[model samples]
Target chain A: MELAQRILVVIRFECRRGMILSRVATALVLAVFPLALVLLVRTQGGDLETGPRGPGILFALLPGLTCLMCLLLWAIPAIHSEVEGSTWPYLAVRPGGKSAVLLGKYLTAVAWTTAVGWLGVSLCAMTMRLSDRLETWCVLGILILLSALAYGALFVLLGVVFLRRAMVLAVGYAFIMEFLTGFIPAVIHRFTIQYHLRSLLSQWTGWTPASLGGAFHQLSLFSPWPAWGHLLALLGGTAALLAAAGCILRQRELIKPESE
Target chain B: MDGPAGTMILLEHVTKLYGTVIGVNDLTASLPQGAYGLVGPNGSGKSTLLNLLTGQLRPTLGRIAVLGQPPWNNARLCQRLGVCPEQDAFYPNITPLEWVRYLLELQGFSGSEASERAEAALEQVGLAETRRRPLGECSRGMRQRAKLAQALAHDPSLLILDEPFAAVDPLGRRRMVELIRRRIAEGKGVVIASHLLHEVEAVTDRFLLICGGRLLASGTAEEVYALLEELPKEVRLRADQPRRLARQLLETELADAVRLTGRDELVVSTDSPGRLYRQLPQLVDRAGVRVFELRAAEGSLQALFDALLRIHRGMKILQPRD
Candidate 1:
């Protein structure tokens, strides 16, 4: 079979298995988390209509926190879960089985996190009273999709590299690269996924750096390219990460340790 | 390069190392297209070799080929090979039908063909009624059968099964043995790895005895048994007038050493058990010994393995007289 068809089969079964009560509950909770935070702020009489806090909070909560958390929950354990469950040998024996499984699970994680992010952003958009609510919703929706794809590929690579401690390693990477380095106004920040995402958010939504003021204004200057440049970078980086993951998975022996 | 034709599996000094531990060490074998029993004790590297054959692992050193092609990362070769691993694990929520169908699809079978083949294979393994049940709900034996079903679903020419009968009951074991025999009769090749000697013996006469990650011996059951004959065999005899019987055997030169374990029982060590069996009745009649029980002390396959291990370790083994 073609590789794409094989990957689709994996995606189908993975999505079906994802519908179990526990997993569905977790997904729902993740989807509602941003909405819950938004409602809590609204109930506390916080002003979301003025200043940059509304878009900033929406970007951070929707694409920023939601995408990272969902990928951690799903993508980072893709290979580890199969090995731990002892189900990897079954998949590993098929033609192109290893690559099919990795790509398929990566796509599933992206789909899952993107859907959850969209739902949370939609819920928050409906509840919040902003002047440019539709534009904010559209921009955040696109960012969430980009975030899921980029973060999903990164976490899948981490899972393939560090099978046992993939989740821990992924969290550390997210903290160091996407959270810490991304916020710094240096050339190194451009290498982080969060940097392009922040650039896209500022350029597309008209939420100028001056609105946030001070140190946040420096981020805009560091990422001076138009929206397409950021889009190309995110998409190109995702493809490169996935390709590297495929190469590593093929070369590495993912067999479980011999019990004999 | 492709392997020599008609060779089902070929290995040349293949070695697999896990960190500092050796899984398969300098293993070399060329097996023809037929049924083979890979026999070994626990920690004997049977699973490791199977993994190497199925491409789940890459040998740390040397080379391996299955079905005329290298197995590692050889997707085309995988199309002709099926493997049922030792681990019994499956997605808990999916039914056996779904699981088998999914695997078949991964093998490139279309949806309809995969379903039809999956159903037929499940039925062949006596899991027709439980095919639709969630794997988590199935018993271990049923799950084991499901594993076999998936392996057979592809209908590959070569089937590599590791400990296939681990959790199967006696009746289920009988059915599986018959099924494997049927596959063999169809001119397909099968390699069954098991720690149980008799289980593999029932399915295939060709045996590969492995120990400590090394190939100790390989041939038919009788060929392996012939190795046991070269060693001294002890026979226990329970009879009245045991001392008289012992004296008669020693005097006749039929027994090498004799010891009285009880008032009525004597153990005899002999180099020629066949001759001793043939002449035992006459010796008993001459001694007026009423014999009650007689049996060889070390006649099992395990004893054969023990003797082979001894020889492999450079220990002395007795040679039969010409």
Candidate 2:
């Protein structure tokens, strides 16, 4: 069998095995979070205009934040879960086993989080009565996919690097690079996934600096490329991170200690 | 990367150290394709050696080659080797059939082929009736069979098992022994590591005795038992006149030392058991003693192992015959 076929097998079985009650509940909660947030703003009679609390800013944050959180739950502990469960050796002994497992789990994470993110954004768009509801849904859907792919690959790489502490390290990386540094109007912000995602959101939705008041408007000044440029960056970044993860996993000895 | 022809495994001065502790101390052996038992006490580096052969660990010093190639990260080599690890962990929610099928798929089998082979392997391990049951809910013996099924499902040329019968009952053990013997009959190599002497003895006569992470001896069962002849042996006898028979044997110098254990029983320790056995009837008849029972107590592998350990420690256990 080809490597891709083996990976597909892993994905098929893993997705089936991941349908336990706890994960199902977590997926439900992720999909409902944005809808709940939108309902809360509407119930409180907050402004839905083009501002800090507008639909554009709200939908923009949904994909990046939601996808990152979802990938943290799935991809950040991919290898660690196998090792802790004592199932890694069985998989590690197969031909192309490490790469197949990593890539399969990474794709599953992306697919899972992207679906959840899309559901959340679609429900939020419907709840807010936006003027350009279809455009808003399409842009957010694409962004959710890009964010899931990018962040899933990033967290999978972190998982291979720091087996036990991948979650803590991933959260730290998100806070420093995506949350804080990504918003700064400098060349360094472009290196963050959040920056390219925000750039694409602003470019696609025609939300300019003057119309959106607050730190959100500053995002437009740093992005100079067309929308396709940011899309390619996200896709290219995902591939690069995944390749690095595969190489590291192949070279590293990820066996559990003999005491286990 | 083929190794020397007919050599199943080759280790040259291999040593594994876990920080400050030694796991496998300077060990060297060359084993050909056949069924062999790796007998050792707990923490005696049996698992460590198995791991090294399976490419799970790198030796701290020296070299190891399995099937003519170094095992470390050798994916092609892995395709020819199957290992049933000592750890008894499995995904709790999936059935044995699903787990085995997934492992076969990872071995590059297509979905239909993997499922078919998985079913056949489970059936061979006598798990066909319960293959669909959740592994976590299965009995320890059933779960052990599931582990073996996954290893055998790949149909590798070599099987390395670490304590395969640890939690199995007598009947289950017999089934496993028969299954392993069938593999050996097919010319497939098998290496079983266990602390149970009789369990390994049932499957293979070739034995490698290890203690304190060192190779004490390696040969056939008869070769190991022949070592016991050089050591002292104790024989027990039931007689009509225990004291009279004991005195007669002592007087004739056939028994090194004899003690009357009961009204009609005596224990004798001897350095030359062959001479004692040959002359025992004459000595008893001369004393008018009727012997009812006679048994040698120190002719087992356990005794030989104990004697070897004693010799390894530089203890003087050999008795001189006069």
Candidate 3:
């Protein structure tokens, strides 16, 4: 009960601190950014129905760009802010405080990213007249949420393990692992978050060779497993990453060596 | 306050190593429930020892039990421990009221109780008026006071403060001293560490002096001085007839050496300060010297530390020869 109270306090603190108007505005803009791009492409006479690139662009915008941006802007910096500001010691010294703080901030990041990412996906899907396809919209929403959770947890882990350099390393990992390796037909791509997200999208959206254009054959991506397997893997991955982050935070000293 | 076994803090053969450098080496001590000043210069392992006792840092070797429980990851023990770190960083954008209130809430205090305690603690620290102002706008002294307020807001059993008096003015330091004295009077235990000797002495006479990652000494100032009986004491006197006083001091054999420091000042070195003090009046009367001021030149805390360091080094030098 006491630990729960502590975690609540941290949640309140982080949430309150995160309510900066400028940052919120930036998130709002980022949320609508993909929708505007899609509309611009459509107005420029890119036949949305016939173009092979339509679904790919939408997938990139809704789940790929949105998840990466939200995690980078919110989750990765959750713990980095404390270490940079030299405030870790104050929180870490509390009873169960370190883990509570980690969990609270992790929740904050997940919520922030999910809310913004959903806003982006919903607006994008609506603008493209895809709202009529209720199943596709629901699947996209779930995929956006799952992406936020997985990416948020991974970024939180990165932030805890490498305080100052977490941002650069996370960006690098996203580019190499999520973007580059995710589409490879090899089994190694299964380890990347993007693979699971794309797999789920392919399975849910039913992106056949015609919808995906010549790119599907060229990429030679593996067929996605059952949606339940993808869902379980994502959920299990988030929990494991979050737990790893908490465990490392509890055992490691909060002291900055440079400050010492 | 020392009951049969009410030891508030016990560090047995504790050592903390920061990579290759030693933070604290083989420190061992047991302190009862009361106020104790941990005094040392900067980089003298004062903060390291405080962090160890607070359970913020685990010892590389040995163990520490505070309030009968190990501090590392021990939430039950931490509930009774409050720490005011020496670092200047804080939630800079938040007001002291919100910051302290949030900290107390984390300690399991309900909303109203946390607010009440936070207000009271801020008031006790003399930050009542500007408690709502952002901490970034507060002066360094005010920030220090605010940090102290949060440390006390939870009403922990043992308050461990690192450099509590840093950046505080003389008046502020006095107020802090009074506050600490009040807490001790209330029977709460406190372990306050600082680089300044007089600041620590202002609050508690029971102290531990550390240097070079070692426990140089621990006790009252008088007791520490007692250990230096072999060292000659220097007393400076300002007299109307300084030369006459110096002559009388030498003639009476009360001083080992007498020298004129100024036109009206005499510096006398004596192996036996008690005998010189006892015979000083007669010596002044015989010489027709009117003494205006008299003080022990080498009785300050820094001087004591210097002497102890010299003695320690001298012993080290003699070890090889022996």
Candidate 4:
């Protein structure tokens, strides 16, 4: 079968049936949050509104916050849930088959975070007359997508590496990588998906690569291919990480004697 | 009851090493496919053998062929192979009807055919009532039956089962054995790994005994039992005036083999059943004792298996220094 077609099949079949309550939760998050955010935050005058900032253009592009949300809320804990319920043995292994179960799950996150999540941002953008900011819309949506891949890959690796304590480490990584990395300056900023993504989005605010851009440039995440190059670099890097993970799962015995 | 011409599985110099540590050491064995029972203790490479046989794992250093084809990564070979792993991992929210149907579809069964096969498989495993319930809600035995249903749904030519009886209730285990026996009667091949020798003895016509990561014995259960011929036969005797009889037997020509087991019983291992049978009436009269209980203490199969296991255990104890 074609790889893309298989991935699409997995995305549809796998995402639908695993968890009933979680399915409802994702649906609610998809359908309700977009409509709710527009009503609630459009009136709030704090950093949520932007009359001088052009009535929420800054806030409309704030799905860069989903960089943080994707790591903590979606990517980090999602693996914990699957592993706790013992789904990996089915989802992970098949003889002579592609080892890209991650693409299915990663697509689920991309679907919710991009389609539903950015729709929320778009709704707030439209409510405040900030919908015409095409750069803001594109950057916000793309950043959320990148954050999903980067953080999703990291958490998937954690699930493979520390199978027993993956949940614990994934949560800690979420807090550390998502919350704390932005505080570190210079080269350290590029290491966190949150930093690279937000920095790229802040670029849509018409800022230079001087602060965010120069830091991101140091990571070799950007080559001559420019933005798409960096996207593929991040993708290729994630694939390499997954390759390392495949080595681990293939080699390590899942059921050790001590437990049995 | 099938002859050697019906042999089902073959392994040559199969050694699976987990890094520097050994998993299944150099093991070689072959047996016909008709309801073969694999008896081994914990960590005896039973599960590893089943995994290697069913294509779930590739052997590290040797060739394994199941039902006349290489199993590892060969989809065509696997279409004829089925496995029931000991692991408890299945879809939680979907009914067995859904999951089993999907698995058959993966094996290339058409939609209607897959559904029919799934229903028949579930019914054969006696899980019809709860086939439509989400598997996560089913009892452990029901879930195990559901797994068995899917394995059989494809009508696999060879079945490799890793501890299929584990965690199953007595009734379920009995039904499972019957199911396997039915398969054997059809001349299909089955390799079932079990810690319990007696449990498998009834279902399987052949035995492959493994111990301490190596093959210990093979062939029919009787043949494996015959490997323990060196162990003494335990003949139990009960008679009036047992002490007096024991005293007289201790002094008799073959007396060195007898031991007083209870107040009125003697357990004897005899090299010559003929001499003992010939002299017993005369000995009873001479000792003024009336003979009562006289029988071999353990069943023939159990005695043979125990004796062989003792030797394996001895080898295990001696292996560290070697």
Candidate 5:
């Protein structure tokens, strides 16, 4: 086979074998999981109101929730594992280049993250089309996809910095930092990709967003483009982080201690 | 290996410095295509050398080329290289069948070929029956086999195995040795970094004996060892009149090679032990000497290894004559 073909084969193979499980994990959490959770909540609450003025809290279920959950729980373990399995050595040895390898996996994570997140939000949107909020839903969904790219790179950097405990750190940042300070002043909240994501979706979904924990009204912040601009910057930042991390990994001195 | 690339690996004054400590220093060696054993003690830098060669670790100084390409960051270079790390890190909740399969899959094997090769490779390493078990559940030896299996499944022309026998039981060691031996016989070049000299000496022809991150000696096992000399070779003589035989032998030129290690046992070191042993009985009979013990002093490989270690601890290089 030609060298380029071999490189492509390796990159695709890396994507499929490395992240397939994490993608499956993402699907379970973002799509089937929320569906199950909603059913369970409604079982005891006795029939959710779906007829008149029924699109109340259901709007909050769209766009950013599944993306956030998947990034936090699923992407955390996935990125952190690149080190643990000793698979990096194998990947580093291939001919396609580490950037290509990282790009392939990053693409896989983004696609899976977007697909599962969209799947759930689309479900809730289908039910809420009664309120003519399709435009709001569409805009919010695009914003979530953009925000996920930034978060994905941030998590990838976490993996490179903390090889063993990257998972714990990613999870902590997701559940704690993002969840806590996401609704502060635009300047402060800009640190988080999810803050911009929620800002873009909160009001249009008929759900209230509180970056300062109920301090802000429903999406009443400044326009969403600044957040969008910052999101793109984050996207570039993720790529840069991945490139730097890949370089470090390339030069890293791996002393493999004799096994027990 | 792209037609051997004429150079399997080369290290030019390659050194790895960790803080003030030196892992490898001003070391240089060129490796061609063949199965070479890297035999050394715990900190002999065998693993470090392998890491440097395979692109897992970069040298702190100098240059390294695997198959004529710098081993660092060049994924294209790695396509022809395969490495089995010494550590026993595994992905939990995954089977050996699945794990090795995925690793091969990452090497760009199609689904069917990857699965088939995974099975064959696992079976070759004696993991076929147990491949379905999650790696977390596999025993230490099994995990090692799984690691090796994945490395071999890629059919890399150069296979680097770091302490391949580590953590394996005696039986497992034998199995691993056979696998390595088989791969080598098939004309695949292998580099096994290990401390078990007996194991290595038995399987490999050429050896790189590393000490203190420097190449002490590289040769056959026998050539690298310190043979017992200067110590008199004790050849026991069975004599009737012990006093008379001792005086007779001591008076002659042959006495220089003789010494008494035990009563009734006189050890003799002769340029020709065979001639002396044949002449002893005739001399004993002629002199009316009593006879009892007859033997030669023996040397052990373990003692030789220890002596080499002691000598290497302070020396920069081993004399070729030792």
Candidate 6:
């Protein structure tokens, strides 16, 4: 088969396998988790728009927390599970087969995470009563896509590099690099995916608050990079990481003694 | 690419090492078309050799070619190679049909063509009835058949199976043996590995023996058994008038040491099996002894392996200071 067709086979296989009722239900619950928080805050007589900047707590929850969480859950296991499950050798022998499998799995993780991110952001925007739903959806939609791509690529790299320790390493990277380091008011903060995402979020949404809270307010201190700049960086970063992962996979032997 | 002259697989001074532990040592071998068994004990590099042959692993310090091309990352050559690994893993929650079809599609076959081949392969492995069932729900034996189905689904020119009879029962083993024979009969070359001596013996008389990641021997069963010239062999005979038979055998020096086990049974141990066998019939005829059964006291392969292993250990113990 052509490389595209082989990739599609894997995509179809992954998507078909992901449609189990239990998995779908878990994804739905996770997609709704942030939206549930929005509803909870509203029920407590708090205004959804009461936050100091951005799309209040709803944006933070949807594109910020939910997107990262879903992709982490979906993308990290995308390749590691196959390697750990001893299914990689079966696929690795085909002509140009490893790239096909890797790209297919990467694409599948992006699709699933992107889908869930869109669902969560849509419901969050609806519940929070954003004035311009289209613009909110558009900006959040792009951020969600970018987040999925960047996190999916990084997680795939982690899966390739650290086969057994991928999940722990990814969780550490997510918590430290994406969450904690992204908020620090320093040049190092710019290294995080969250930095570009927040930069893009601020640039597109036009939410330049004078003063807010803690690091959330400090994020407004840095000059917002042009929307194109952040988008380009995210795309370039994702491509570089994925290509590196492919190279690593081609170089490393995936088989272990136990598997033999 | 066509294979070299008459050779299907050729390895020249191939050595594979995993850190300090060796997987396959400095070894060279050439296998021709038709069927051959790879026999070895666990961790003796049977799977490692098959992996190298299938292009799943590369040699550390030598060259390997299957059908005239290096197997490492050689996609074109991989199209002509199929491997059934020892691990029992299948794509999760999917029917065997879908799994097999997907693998065939990866080999560049279109969906419909892949489906047809998958069905036929599954049928050949006797999985036609349960082809639609989820692999996770299948028995160990059925799953083994499924593994074979996928490997054969592409109908590659060379089929390499690693420990194909690992977890199979007697009946399943018989079925697998038949399937392997059928594949070989179709003019495709096969290299099957198993630690089970009887399993490999049942499939092919031509076999290779590997131990300590080295090629110990390779030939027909009789030829390999002939390598055990240093080891004594015991043969038991049950016959009427056994005393007369034993007396003739002792007088001729044919029996190195003969012991009477029962009223009509004699166990004879000899270093020269050929001379003993040549003299046994004459002695029985001269004594008018009616021989009912003549059997090796131990499994030939097992006894040879034990002797080789003992010599190997002896060499290890006698090693010079590093």
User: Could you say which candidate leads in TM-score?
Assistant: 1
lDDT of 5 at A115: 78
State chain A's TM-score for model 4: 0.70
For model 1 chain B, the run of ten residues with the poorest summed lDDT: B313-322
Task: Tell me how each candidate scores on DockQ against the true complex.
Answer: 0.76, 0.51, 0.56, 0.20, 0.30, 0.61
lDDT of 2 by residue, B1-322 (tens): 4557899999899998877778888888889999999998888889888888888788889899999999888889889988888888677788999999999999988889999999999998889999999888999899899889999998999999988998888887888889999999999999999998888899999988888788887888777666565557899999988888888888888888998888888999998787787788878787887889998886677777777778767733332233
- TM-score of structure candidate 2: 0.89
Model 6 lDDT per residue over B1-322, tens place: 3446978888898998888878988878878887888888889888888888877788899998898888888989889988888888766688889888888988889899999999999898788999999988888888888888888888889988887776677877788889888889899998988888888888888888788888877777777566564357788999987788888888888878888999889998888776777677877887888999998766578776676677666543111112
Looking at model 5 chain B, which ten-residue stretch has the lowest summed lDDT? B224-233
Candidate 4, residue A101: CA error in Å? 3.9
**lDDT accuracy of residue B210 in candidate 6:** 81
Per-residue lDDT, model 2, residue B58, is 86
Instruction: Count residue pairs with overlapping backbones in model 2.
Output: 1
For candidate 6, report its TM-score. Answer: 0.91
- Against the hidden true structure, what lDDT does model 4 obtain? 0.63
- TM-score to true structure, per model: 0.93, 0.89, 0.89, 0.76, 0.74, 0.91
Ranking by DockQ: 1, 6, 3, 2, 5, 4
Writing each residue's lDDT as its tens digit, candidate 6 over A1-260 gives 48899999889888987788887887798789977876777789876654443264555776678777777777777767877777887888888888888989899988888888889888876766776777788988888888889988999999888887888898899888877887677889877888888777667766544445454554543446777888888899999999999998887777765554
Clashes of each: 0, 1, 0, 6, 20, 1
**lDDT by residue for model 5 (A1-260), tens:** 53344445544554545455665765766676545655666678744334322233333343446665566654554434555566555555555434444555555566667777677656656644245556645765676577568777777667656767877887788767676666455476666665556545544453443423455545434445654565566666777766776666555554443311
Residue-level lDDT of model 1, residues A164-252, one tens digit each, is: 98999999999998888887778888999988998898888877667867876555434779889999999999999999999999988
Q: In model 2, where do residues sit more than 4 Å from their true spots?
A: A48-56, A59-61, A208-210, A215-221, A226-229, B1-3, B232-294, B305-322
Candidate 5 lDDT by residue in tens digits, B1-322:
2324566777788998767777777887777778888877888787778777777677889988877788766666677777887767576667888877666655667778989999999998889899899777988889988888888988888898888777778877788788888878998888888787777765686778787888876665556543333223456665545667777676655556555545566666665444556577777777787787665554454444555666578674654463
Give the local distance difference test score of model 3.
0.80
The CA lDDT at B177 in model 6 is: 88
